[model samples]
Target: MTEPARDTIHCARFLPHPPAAVWRALTDPELHARWWAAGDVKPLVGHRFTLDMGSFGSQPCEVTAVEDERLLAYRFAERTLDTTLTWRLEPEGTGTRLFLTHSGFDLDSPMGRQAYEGMGRGWPHVLERLDAALGEAA
Candidate 1:
């Protein structure tokens, strides 16, 4: 029998910037669009927004938690996939270590399985884009 894939995607990187800067990149809409999806992301809880996901259309999201420059969590694709994306930041030697956990994927469904696999491949590239965006902000 074949083993099933894990139902979560996790990524982490040490960015050469302060947590505040990284937090801005994650929250500020313009900077966020330059890195990830285009959305009016803010560091406020209980805010609802939508992201332009290219061909996937607008995906609904809701701010679930915020902790200044340390953490941000949200419900992504709330209308459909209902996944939670959490970003954790920690200070590290004058820079910041960023960690991401995209969980709540239902591996039994085809859409969920596909998204899990696709996002697993795509997040690394997105993080690289984040790096470039932060570089431009410098």
Candidate 2:
């Protein structure tokens, strides 16, 4: 018998900012904290960091892959949730198209299911906050 496929959260947002600007928002700790969680995220592979996820406490993360301002993939939540978050930035017209893939949800577990559902609903708002943060920077 085979197990079921895991759930993955996919989100895309077109920000009216250059890829470099969006990339800074994703990589720079202060800019990232303004939009998302506070973390020492860097565009360097194999770097380890912790994101302060507010009420959910801090989550450990590790940079698994990075490609300059183009792509970044990281292991999120480490041993507990054990998920991967990949961010892809593509230049689009006058702005940037940002794609987010949050995968490795073990839906069989209650914690995983809840997190999958919660984050699925929460990502849009998070992206909106990112846009607002970019606007402030602009």
Candidate 3:
């Protein structure tokens, strides 16, 4: 059996907003629900959340850590497949760099491979949506 996809993937994007703005969107349940899923998602440390994407799939995540306007981490305690999620924001001159990573997937399995590809397509669109919100807010 292949090992799980631990810390093996990296996705990054630059959002045109200050770190504080991006951080709010990341850590606030309401703001996150707006762009992500309009459901229960509290981004506080130790809070558990479920990302229900209708019939697509549902992911259960637990907040792991938070550092002011810098980083947020979640462990995917339950999923259609195994994964850990995290978001890191670093302030640039006039904006923030956002990085999202999902780890611990068994890519050799069909389900795992499917999830891997799906996330690859999904994250960029989500980032684009966040970019628009940031742009309009600025």
Candidate 4:
């Protein structure tokens, strides 16, 4: 029997900042570029943009949902993986708890499996970068 394909990557982190600060890091294109890729990311529904993923080229994206500093969801790499990336932020004492979910990977395909594995390792580093960026800003 073939092994089941993994279809989602979830990561969470607690940052020593308010939700608004964390949200800005997630939405601001310049701040985003510091952590992950460069993109015209905004917390506005129906916005469309592309992220420069270095050697992976540019990935087309569209904002599917937005809830101010609470949540942001977008369709990432629409022409490629067609996955959905969601970010959720919740107030926790003096800081915010940030959660990321990247879903809809078609693990049956070789590309999907490869991406899942690569991103599984890459996402943590990306989050660490985000933390470092926030530290610099703070």
RMSD to native for every prediction? 3.1, 2.9, 3.7, 3.3
- lDDT tens per residue, model 1, 1-138: 965337889999999999999999999999999988899888899999999999999999999999999999999998689999999999999899999999999989999999999999999999999999999999
Rank the candidate models, highest lDDT first.
2, 1, 4, 3
For candidate 2, lDDT tens digit of each residue in 1-138? 965345899899999999999999999999999999999999999999999999999999999999988999999999999999999999999999999999999999999999999999999999999999999999
Candidate 4, 1-138: lDDT as tens digits: 965336989999999989988999999999999999999998888999999999999999999999999999999999789999999999999999999999999899898889989998989889889989999998
Q: Which model is ahead, 2 or 4, in terms of lDDT?
A: 2
TM-score of each predicted structure versus truth: 0.95, 0.95, 0.83, 0.94
**Considering lDDT, which of the candidate structures 2 and 3 is the better prediction for this target?**
2
For candidate 3, the per-residue lDDT at 113 reads 80
Q: Write the per-residue lDDT of candidate 3 for residues 1-138, one digit (tens) a residue.
A: 987355356778987788999987876666776677554655578888777666766778788888888888887637457577788898888889999887877788897888777877788888888777666655
Off by over 4 Å in 1: 1-5
Model 4, global lDDT = 0.92
In model 4, what lDDT does residue 137 have?
Answer: 91
Residue 2 lDDT in candidate 1: 62
Q: Which residue pairs clash within candidate 2? A: none
lDDT comparing candidate 2 with the true structure? 0.95
Collision pairs in model 3: 5-104, 5-105
Model 2 error, position 80 (Å): 0.7
